[model samples]
Target: MKVYLAAVATGLLLIAESANAISVNVQAGRHFTHTSAAIGDNSAGLSFNGNWARSDHNGQLGSLGTAFSLPVGPLTASIGGKALYLSPKDGKNGEALAAGVGLSWTVMPSLALYGEVYGAPPRLTSGIDSYAEAAGGLRFTVFKPLTVDAGYRVMNMRGKEGNRDNKLADGFYIGAGLNF
Candidate 1:
């Protein structure tokens, strides 16, 4: 996967040296319980969410995204896509791809709210099963360089079709971002 990402990123950089509107980051957090979609008799599975050492733990998640802004008379809109990858302590990692589009009213010079969604095609990694989160969230920027965001994401996969065999993942997420 690293090789694939490196190749694609390298290609993008080579062909698109003008892509200055981009942000790449890494995030780790205690994904709230709701993000796990705990069904009956499966509460124990979610208990280990924050336990990075456990298979279900949500450890360091990396995200890469690019945005392009277009001006239309009085309104300005930005459309972009992002990829999120999370490597669990239990040795399972899932990669998701999101093609998102949003509009900003630019009510203030430093503040704007945008809605976006992320989705994954399908993949397998390691022995632990995992799938993508077809999720949506809102992002609000403050001070122009920092942003706070919250959203819900869900993905369903058939056994062996995902990394964790046949288990499903569905849940809500809250996160933030910083831009340079």
Candidate 2:
């Protein structure tokens, strides 16, 4: 856990140097905590992101990815791929490469909605049969650079062997974000 935290912290520091825009988010739930950072702008820039999550059921999961964003009217759409490393408390560790899409819409100056889905088939995974994740949330901007959000997320992984399937995270989470 300490190692993962350090890696994310280092990534954040690196991102702060050259990114035109940057954001960091932290989330917590009953038995789960997640942290992520991204650097880029919505109009058209290469976005780099990294995330770490720890859960009672899954132990830990971490990912790194890059995305390209395109703006259409009041919405922004992104396409990306992520490389995921998963360590389960009672199962074998695994790696997966997932392809994903995300969409965000600004409803008002202060409110927005966002959703994303990522998945990896058995062929794109190792030590695990498959991986999938979906999340959506409503975000409220408290001010220009601060926001709060609430959301539901579900992440699942199926191990190669039976009895190793794990629901890494499921249910609601509340989070806050800083954008600069």
Candidate 3:
């Protein structure tokens, strides 16, 4: 928790000096794993994507920071850290500051294919120390400001005192979002 706060504090400090734009995205999904039946794995969250106030040695904004935006040929590649607060059905809650990286390919004007990988270390989590996830999905621009998406994700978490990790969730989800 301290690490997450420190990271956010550092990011906010960096943002104070730059002229950047923020893009918001919200998502919700269902899970299939029963390893932790006490916590039904449904999840939802929102994120802010933006360029930081400073540029790296490579002249890329947030290139070496907690957030980054870089274009690789026809694909847009981005990486950032996200703090997540998850509420389970059984109430055995979990929180983690996870770092994620993703790539998107616009195969068509209104359609794109994307994939992302996210992981949270023990230092960033409470109770459970290690968490990891991977997802792939299709995104369709439904209107000028709205997009509809569907995807599948797999995630697992391990306790600090335990030798084995628990499979948390694996399922498909449908969602909609507005991008500005």
Best by lDDT: 2
Supply the TM-score for candidate 1.
0.41
Per-residue C-alpha lDDT of model 3 across residues 65-87, encoded as one tens digit per residue: 24455666667777767655533
lDDT scores in order: 0.42, 0.87, 0.56
**Highest TM-score model number:** 2
Question: Each candidate's root-mean-square deviation in Å?
Answer: 13.3, 8.1, 14.1
| C-alpha RMSD between model 3 and the true structure | 14.1
Residue 134 error for model 2, in Å?
Answer: 0.5
* Winner of 1 and 2 under TM-score: 2
Rank by TM-score (best first): 2, 3, 1
| Steric clash pairs (candidate 1) | 35-171, 129-163, 129-164, 130-164, 159-166, 160-165
TM-score of each predicted structure versus truth? 0.41, 0.86, 0.58
lDDT of 1 by residue, 1-180 (tens): 999999999999776544332332222223422212111111011111111111244344445555565655434555555555555443455555555555545445554444434444445332334334344555566665566656554433222333333223345556555443
* Residues forming the 10-long window of minimal summed lDDT in candidate 2: 38-47
Better of 1 and 2 by lDDT: 2
Find the number of clashing residue pairs for candidate 3: 2
- Sliding window of 10 residues with minimal summed lDDT for model 3: 34-43
Clashes of each: 6, 0, 2
